[model samples]
Target chain A: MPGVCASSTQSPLEGKVSKVKWPTYLSLSLVAMILGVLLVFQFRVVRYIEQGVSLGRVQELTVELRQLEKEKLKLAAEASDLSAKLQQAGQGQAEAEKALEGELEKARLLAGLVPVTGPGVEVTLDNPPANRGWATSLYVIRDEDLLRVVNELRGAGAEAISINGQRIVATSEIRWAAPFINVNLTRLVPPYHILAIGNPGNLRSALEIPGGLVEYLQELGVQVKIQAHDRLTVPGYNRPLEFRYAKPVVKE
Target chain B: MWLGVWLTLLGLILGVIVGLNIPMVLTKAHAKYLSVAVLAALDSVFGGVRAAMEEHFDHTIFLSGFFANALLAAGLAYIGERLGIDLYLAAVVAFGVRLFQNLAIIRRHLVRGIKRG
Candidate 1:
């Protein structure tokens, strides 16, 4: 304020225009102005150092870890309770059954009969809706296109995969039957979102590698979005398993 | 004070506003050098102000000191990095000490001038 109305605040020494010049004022004020901007930047740097993850981000991450820990505790308690019951009922047979039960649980997970949740990647595939022109179906997503993506995900060590909520197991088939793609006998509507549970880095790189399925789909006018998640839940397979002709061969 | 000093300040404010809105910002990696440069600028500004009050302000000396302090502080920090040491700490302390000393002298000069008047 004082500097703005120069004459009113001008001291006796500064009144000598012979001593004070335009350059001094210009340089000083310019330096002060630059200092203001640098101050703001320095403030930002200090803030980032103090809190790399800003407020409201830590809670959600802790929630996922908490859920996983709860499940682990539940499993351990069940194991301990079962062993105690078996000890009361008399002994070695139940011990074997307990181990077998653990194995069965793992197999059921592999068969996609149980709901699973973990860190994973979600992929969404769609066709550009605005460009629905003549012979556009030729450029649309096909069963083979989906198959290629599934194949790539599997190769990248994906433990579980689902297309449009349909889990892909050993017997699941991806097929094209005129105007729609089928996964496990269920027709899918685009945009087809595929969720794969695996190392996110590995899964992303598998699909996004140069000239890979995602790029190929893009070339065919199919839009693809791949995102990694800290906690992704895939629905359990709803279809029943039935076997009549095929029988399990037993060891002699 | 120069008549156009306000214009220089206005230009600086406008430049910062426009540039920052354009999302031009120093990243975290550049913070180390930026902090040192800021300290150097602060020292130069104080020194300049003291010289101005004593009626011996020289543009060449002021500008040269400004750039030299910034570059030398940055260079010391770089050399420290190469030698696996914290040489920038020296710049910070040296500048900090000079800053307060300059501030005290400026304050004493102001007090004497006010009492005389």
Candidate 2:
């Protein structure tokens, strides 16, 4: 049967290639081309996933952050309204008005409601040079470092403190929120500028003291810069202070 | 054999240029499905090449196999996801093994043809 088949038919198995079909060649080539395009797209998608959050998730988070910020602004306006009302009510009694005004001024200062200006020190923390290898977490500033620095400043008699223009009130929290540093719930990037209202000499000497925060941060390869200015201004806290639980005791 | 290879290469070059110029953004959730489909298509192409070398290539079979394999791979991935099982991985492993097998056969055919010449 094999011999009869070979003799009767000119088979492709005999080594003489058959004439190629143009349509089949075209279709196969088209399919291969599509596969090539898909391969590139797959590589891109994998890389994007490895780098960080998905594009859709990023967009969703951004929108949420914006909405929260708007709510914060609205609450801040309401607090200011209450403060103005309190000031107007105090105007009714002339004899006790002077003493009450003085107390109100002191309360405003402590609550970070009034902006402060004084001779103080400015500390700047920046990411280390990129050539030092990008993967190491030590080269970047962390939340704990910022907290330590703020605590040291307060200990050295800093009347007011602000990080990247966000005032650090008594209720303020400094934390790491993944790819960002959140100070008083506001997101901050690298190259942080921490301003303190205090005696310039005292603040600078406190940071530069042996085994202090500055030295510790330097050991971690973080760029730290300290400068004293004759006059510096710190903004008031922007968020509203809600006092829901505490009430002043009434004496008969 | 050389004609098919040349045609494939030309198509790839053209496809790359077109793919880069157009922005084809797929959501992150659906990226895995496309990836599995691509792998299945790749396996089918290699199988078709091996069949052609063995003198049993059929155009209809090749076309049908290409689409069917890709769709089935993607479907399996989706079903697996719904079932909370990694079904895409199964497709990946299967296609990967078959791709290597087809590649080995094609390599053997080329080497034998070279030695004969």
Kindly report the fnat of each predicted structure, to 2 decimals: 0.16, 0.32
lDDT of 1 at A185: 97
Per-model DockQ: 0.08, 0.13
Q: Report the C-alpha lDDT of model 1 over A1-252, residue by residue, as the tens digit.
A: 222221111223433323546676666556566766666667667666666653356667788789989999999999999989978777777877998999999889978999899988999988655555655555678888888888999999888899999999878999998778888899897899999999999999999999888888888778899999988988889898878888999989
- Residue A128 of model 2 has an lDDT of 74
Q: Which ten residues in a row are the worst by lDDT in model 2 chain A? A: A1-10
Q: Which residue pairs show backbone clashes in model 1?
A: none
Candidate 2 - CAPRI tier?
Answer: incorrect
